[model samples]
Target: MATVYLDYNAGAPLRPEVAAAIAAAWAAPGNPSAVHGPGRAARARIEAARAEVAALVGADPAGLIFTSGGTEANAALLAGLAVPRLLLSAIEHPSLAVAAAARGGEEIAVGPDGVIDLADLDRRLAADPRPALVSVMLANNETGVIQPVAEAARLVHARGGWLHCDAAQAAGRIPVALDALAADFLTLSAHKMGGPPGIGALVLADPSRQLASLLLGGGQESGRRAGTENLPGIVGFGAASALVGDDLAPDGPTFRVGALRDRLEKLALARVPTARVIGAGAPRLGNTSCLALPGLAGATQVMALDLAGIAVSSGPACASGRQRSSRVLAAMGLPDTVAGSAIRVSLGWASTDQDVDRFVAAWGELAGRKGFTVSAPQAA
Candidate 1:
């Protein structure tokens, strides 16, 4: 039995090019903040990586600030902004609303398609007169549903509010133009895009505009994020970003991966009697399929798939294998029966047709089994 990994949303496998870049960086050791000759070389390397990462999203290199990952970047943005209120989409990642009440933040509603309701956003913005910050993810990490970010940015700006778009899952899958999206702030994670883990960025559309520092002591990241940069991780991230730049075309690997996802979804729906998709009505990432089986528990499905050497997920990877309902689906108004039964199977650049075939065959076999859901593993 061959093992198939379909959980790209959790973290994509490190690309060989990224690994090579990281290895090359690791061979040399110098703090980017130091003033010696080695330090100057390190700084030059970091700057080159910065340009690649910035170019990936059509952002100015000066506007990009390197951070530990998406989580820290989001926390910094949320904490740094001096807004009197924060309004986030109901389907945003937990990082956005971790301290909703304490930070004077409230969730904007989303329709059943898992898409942000612009009317609701406008109403909420109009309902409040204070300076506000609105955070909406470009694409959901779980359902992979793309949000109306450009439209939402218009609404946010109409009321003098800044918009933050989390593009962690969207950057490599789709084209991300800072000006086209009209986002004031955006976030990206390298691990989600075939780079090494523990590296990501927070982009400011305005390079000259200053944000408060999360780490108080250093002049790193333009005094915004205070720490010596992770050179190897950043280099790996840049390599991954550059790779995405090459393949994000209609006739590239992205298109083939999308075909794999569609084939898997069509096969699952045809073979499984109770199969359903959570955001089938909405435009979603080409590589993700949030398939649901009405009577099966998501955890059980996850465990069953694992047994067949097929990797999938109940929802967000942050759930960390917990047997709980999905907040994303809940926000979309999905009932517990449907929400609890959904599993996410996300593909990537390295995925293949064989992987899709294996998944469909395994899933169909599981659907035909009796009492397969019982006595399943509790954790991924």
Candidate 2:
């Protein structure tokens, strides 16, 4: 059997267009900051790619700052915004969580469906009468549950607080309009959207808002982030961003992936009566499913599926190689046992019916060995 990769949320396979763009960028020479023919060419490439990435989220190109990855982008925003306090959703990615923690952040609870409790958020802001930054993810990377960012934004702005959204998982998988979301700062990762892993961006909804520079040399990224840009990665990011239009379209690849995801969930649930689909009641990304199988450890399922040529993840790929219960699920009020048994299967732009079929088959076989026989659903 061919290998089926269902770990798109971790890092999607690079698209051919993005690969070609990286190769083209590698062939070119010169620093983007240098004043010369080659340097001017490099600068142009970076700017063009920046525009493409900015367009993906309906952001102004002028406010986009390139960072090493989503981690750095999140850190930069948390630090640069210089908010004395931070209020973050409990289910934020580790990067945001760490950054927020460093700033003495307070955790806002999410409902059992994995959505932030807006009333709790409002209450938190009211309790803390300081100028705080509210950081909530556009979608939970683990459960794929979409957050009510626009509503959160209104709450934050009304309290004279800044709202920063981590849109890494939501950008290519759903409609992520930065202005429409009313986010003061937004973070994105290229790898999450089929681009190179080392590059990402922080988009400012209002370019006039001053963000302090984290790095202090060469004055790159409009003096917000220092260090020479990753030209090849940025070029690949632009290429990937250009391809996201189809994924965001109403009748697009994302919808097809969503159908496959739904099929997989339906079959899994029908086969294993004890299994639970996390975040099923909430609005979610089209291409994601978080499956929690009682009496089965997530790590064991991941390993078994891997042996069967199916690649799935117990949680965020970043948290891979470690044995730990999913904090995202725990935040949603799941018991430790259920959280520990949860695994995430995410589809993407290149996912197909065959890929979904293979995964379902492998999963069913594995479940059967554990004394649960999962029968495939009849084709409609």
* Best-performing candidate as measured by TM-score: 2
Residue-by-residue lDDT tens digits, candidate 2, 1-380: 67899999999999888999999999999999999999999999999999999999899999899998888888888767766778999999898887677767899999999999999999999987887899999988999999999999999999899999999999888888988899989999999989999999999988778888878877888878888899999999999999999876888888888888998887778767678999999999988999988778999999999999999999988788889899899999999889999999999878888888777777878888998756655452
Off by over 4 Å in 2: 376-380
Please state every model's RMSD to the true fold in angstroms.
3.8, 1.3
Question: In candidate 2, what residue range of length 10 has the lowest lDDT sum?
Answer: 371-380
Model 1 C-alpha lDDT per residue in residues 142-220, reported as the tens digit of each score: 8989999999999889899899999999989999999999999999999998999999899999998778888888899
Give one clash count per candidate, in the order shown: 0, 0
Query: TM-score of predicted model 1?
Result: 0.96
